[model samples]
Target: MDGDLVVDGNITDVDDGAAALIVLGNLRARNIYLAGDAKLVVHGHVTAETFVGDMTDKLVMIHGDLRATVSIFWNEFCPDLVAGTLHGRTLAPAYLDLSTAPIGCLADPAPEAPLSRLLAPELLVTGAPGPDDLTEIGIRGDALRDRLLGGLPLTTTP
Candidate 1:
């Protein structure tokens, strides 16, 4: 239609001094709006369906499908945004697959899961078939939200 643009990746650093960086080397315009100030050094799996910016241009980091619509700046780059990011609409699109599914537990994990950069083919956690024993592969929903945030320890209740 007229609202299906996407931006892959770019902007290595430019929080200030005028701002105006760009990247998203593909998939353009889903009512997009990423302003400027460059700073997307995540490299590897990159994606973007739609998202606008503030906080000096994406300083609200939370890499992994930033379905930004209009305004949602929490600073410190996605400060564990349990209720932020998702402006205009069309949430979830920063790259996901958790190997599949509703992304088991709503994605956003990762503490130290490097499984050799994974590519499928059984993600055995460690040695004698790990992952607490095994049987739950096909993970990708942003790496099962970074493995459901293993180690779990980032408070902010209220």
Candidate 2:
């Protein structure tokens, strides 16, 4: 994009053939979901509620700071380069390359579970929620993950 991009909802890339994106300015979004091979580069800062990068060969490079409530990198091959500071909770594979280590952040190594398993339903409902909200519903983790991986929206009207 030529200038700053603001997304009210989410930015999801599930297609394997998705095109690469280059943002000249900052990017503000609710969430970012990447499960494709396309590369994403942001020259300016990136502000989001959550960022989920599943199994993919994409490289995400941010020239400026990245501020989010939660950032999850599920695959070791997914390389994320952040030139500036990173602020938030980061759940990533130990081998993943995040150029700059986060500051005063809670970093967690992703478990053997799928990407969706790390995301709680409350996150989709509310931008940020308490950790205990994960079990507030009756759905199993695996089941929820499967549904999410299958392209089902977590929060939708019947």
Candidate 3:
């Protein structure tokens, strides 16, 4: 798109063949969920509360800087490349290669807790939860994934 794209709620699915979403300008959203071989290319900066990629073939390329509170490469096949600086927390499997991108504040979930239990999807979209909130009680795994796939905001307001 030409100008900045601002999404008040989450940007989910976008599972097209290639380059599902392309933005010439900046992109700002509450959260972004990419799956099913989805690809997102942002020429300008990206500002989101949370960014999650959940497919082996998924790709998220940001030419400009990216600022996200929580960024998760949920699947081992997902390749997230940030050409510019990346600022915020990131969660990824140890097997995933994120060396190409400079990630700040990488958070690893406790051994007892799986990656899915790290954060509450609803709070991620509706409230401002920091890295410390990972332990907070909330939905997770299938329930969270289903909510994201449903593409309905947990609350009417962001």
lDDT of 1 by residue, 1-158 (tens): 12232433322232454553233222333222333454332211223322323234443233234432221121112322212223222222233222242212233433433333322223223334434332232222232223222422111111
Better of 2 and 3 by lDDT: 3
Q: Write the per-residue lDDT of candidate 2 for residues 1-158, one digit (tens) a residue.
A: 99999987677776576688789999997677777585789999888866666666777888887776656666443435677766766655555545444332223333334334545543332434444223232333343344445545443221
Error of 2 at 121 (Å): 5.4
Q: With candidate 1 superimposed using the best TM-score fit, by how many Å does residue 130's alpha carbon deviate from the native?
A: 30
TM-score, candidate number 3: 0.66
TM-score preference between candidates 2 and 3, better one: 3
Global CA lDDT of candidate 3, please? 0.62
Give stretches of model 2 more than 4 Å off.
Answer: 95-158
Off by over 4 Å in 3: 14-19, 100-118, 121-139, 150-158
Question: Clash totals for all models, in order?
Answer: 33, 0, 0
Segments of candidate 1 deviating more than 4 angstroms: 1-4, 7-13, 20-76, 79-115, 118-158
lDDT of 3 at 47: 88
The full ranking of all candidates by TM-score, starting with the best, is: 3, 2, 1
Q: Ten consecutive residues with minimal summed lDDT in candidate 2? A: 132-141
